[model samples]
Target: MPEPANALQRLHVHLNETRLLGSISSALYYDQNTVMPAAGAEWRGEQLALLASQIHARQSSARYAELVGEAEAELEAETKAELGPSVPTERRRNLQLVRLELERQRCLDPALVASLARAQSKGNALWQTARRHNDFPTFAPALAELIALRREQAGQLAAAEAVPRSPWEVLAQPFEPDISKTRLEELFSPLKATLPGLLEQVAAAPAQQGGLNEAAAELPEAEQESLCSELLNSWGYDPARCQRSRSAHPFSCTLGPQDFRITTRVVPGQPFSSFLATAHEWGHSLYEQGLPRSTDHYFPWPLGEATSMGVHESQSLFWECRVARGRAFAARWQPRFVAGAGGDPWGGVDGFWRALNPMRPGPTRVEADELSYGLHIVLRFELELALLEGGLPVADLPGEWNRRMVELLGLRPASDSEGCLQDIHWAEGLFGYFPSYALGHLISAQLAAAMQRQIGPIETHVAAGQERVVQQWLAAHVWPLGRAVNGEELVEQVTGERLSAAPFLSYLEAKVQQLLASAHH
Candidate 1:
């Protein structure tokens, strides 16, 4: 084999081993969330620490660096070759992946990586316990440790190379590679400027009175599970390939090319919570299931993996916001929901729709409405950026979080569980993941617009119970590409336009307006 070919083979071997380790880590994470007892938290932290050290050792190994260097040289030579352009393109792509891994690995010391992994594992447990007791102080020290480690990691990444943008940009790259702070501000500035007024208009509009508010009264867990299964089957999820379970914070995970798992929490009075969460998670699983199988199976290569969390969020938002909250969906499923909750089915489609789109400010990010959801993200983005920049101390997070909640959403959390301890992202050391939720909303609107153009009336199809049509459209245009394209390129390819705030803003304005108009009549 040529030097480049040999390097490529070695890189692949390293990547495959890293991928296996990652898969095991993912499974362990799932276990931690779903089945592991509290007593196991310390051991889990050690296991994760060991795994992180192993992965870091493999990544930072001198042999790996040599292989990457050789691959880079081969890529340059192939770039200069004139005979077969496609070969060079493939080589350059592979080289790009290798270089990205090298840069990421080189940015953080192995000790720091191991420390972060252990901190995150322990922090998760602390967060759970703190949340259960509605106490932030109990988890504050662990959170502070995580914040310190993440800030150090950000600094390390910034020092690895001269980054053109802010340190936050470099830190955010792992979650949303190629996205700049300027771009995020451009996409979000308009929403920030316009949403308050829009929200006021909807809130002042005649209140739609008649929706069910079946507070978590006494719903059985078994019944909730059964209903979740029914909804999953209705959504075309095959039980053999996809499984569901319960977790404190619901999430979806893909174990392999074919295996996917989703979790939902059962809120006693509000059975819709679990059902809707199931739908949201199903959206994510469907995207994973629909990824192009022809490409290699391992993640981090940008072949079968997701393009970005923003794109992945779009899939879930499409199902949860666009489809589940729509008039047609509520009309078809309201009967089942009413029957399950023993509520009045007479709430009418308009009333049910308004209830679904309620614009109340909330403490929980996951339960936030479309209009106010971005505000939640903006709070975290600012806090994390400050933390990364050394402008804020982790010790001040609870106060800062409470202040931001009041400033942004005009509400304050009654307890720490509803405030600083709400999300699992920070506990897991996911510093840059919050913004993707809002970004996903924008992408979903853009993609939905494109789907409408291609498939002719989506609302009509949705109202007529033709979810398969929408699913098929997304599978064909969006899901199959996987990480074969980046988020911006995928948006452009599907929408024939660049990424912009207009599509999302327009969709939100129209939906809110329709809801308001219907409520009045």
Candidate 2:
């Protein structure tokens, strides 16, 4: 009856409406992180909690589940006579994805959902204060609460699943399905074994800094902002379509389809840090800009969204590390750097390249060089496993974090702010997110290798500022497809290589040699 409810059409309308709701929610989140006055956090928290509750209820509602089920039934029932010779492939995929999401939402507890929102809201504020004060105790309680809430959420997911799983594994599924601790250990083992020695060799090399970065410390915030804007335009981001500004931590979010916003923070006296952050966040904005969307709508349905956080991070890292930190790219932009700072601070592109790609370890992960970035992730991943599964007490995290930093990077953080509290992930209850950044580097290298094999040398295009050639290749092979497949499938489909860290490691080893040679000369 009722012509089987026009499942695809109804589902599209409902999903679009859901996307609209999500856009509004994202706007509030953007403002909270960007423009929201610090005093207004309480009101903002309430707004976020209410939105979270409403969205969860709507998504997990009986009628919504029924509609999804009916849509699935229709997919199975419809024949050539009713439909046509060809299947509605896209619609079928969308419905299938939506159905899976609906089932997941159904498993979530509304009360827990609201509590998690509240935890994030409060946790962020406390983290800001704690970081500013360099007081781990101040943020520890909130962190502990957020961790508990995440654990509870993971338990709920595990309860609904057919197979038994660890809490970390269950938590990871939301970011990357089929991700497991066992799998991650196997993948990270090589990097853990190799990076320390590499760091020692590179750091010990002559001309590590080459005195190119001295002028960078004197660059002001205003000048950096202008340079960032120039960099944005150079990357082909439309000013009207996308916006950039300052934030506590650099990030990118979409407030509307055409409204892409990215935030980069300027560290006074560390001139190039913000530039790199801008590049990193811009990569995120570009991915958002390139995702498949409804021509009339800004928010994409599930199939149009990023497949996984790892893939999203890959896109960002590709631009930030693969392109921006490349020797050719540094050569092309040397004139601009001199112009921006009013002098040739780096002396030449060779010195400029060394400054941008540090081989030494650092306290901050976001500011880490390509060679050391994966080690940062490895440290975080090991810490998370301990916190979530190894029974490590939250109160002892600062010490544990410091110990690991010394062990992994041979540099201990001066304070908890630069150590355990550096990232916003734990503040927002994002335990499974760190691994993605390392995974991203791997995917970017693998994908870059594939792109090179298919096209020409990547450096050739990037050096000439012909980024569109690289962008177009990714657009054709990666962004448009979105989450149609999982991360492994996406990598294999594009690169003809199964997911592995070897490509990323190989790429880095070559980069180290290049940096060393540049240093020597």
Each model's lDDT = 0.80, 0.83
Query: Which segments of model 1 are wrong by more than 4 Å?
Result: 1-7, 69-83, 86-91, 160-162, 213-220, 295-300, 343-346
Q: Please, what are the lDDT tens digits per residue for candidate 1 over residues 1-521?
A: 44334666666667777877887888899899999999999999999899989988888788889877876776566667854565635456556666776877887888899999999999999989989998788888888788788778877887655456567777677667688877888888888887777777766764643354535323467767887888888889887788888999999998766679999998665556787788899999899888766544345454667778889999999999899888888888767655665665436667767767776667888888888888888888888887777578777888998998888888899888889888998888788888888889999999999999888877799888789999999998999766657888889988999988899889989888787778767
Residue range 178-230, candidate 2, lDDT tens digits: 78888888888998898887888886775777747574536767878888888
Which candidate number maximizes lDDT?
2
**Cα lDDT of model 1 overall?**
0.80
Pairs in clash, predicted candidate 2 = none
Error of 2 at 355 (Å): 0.7
Clashes of 2: 0
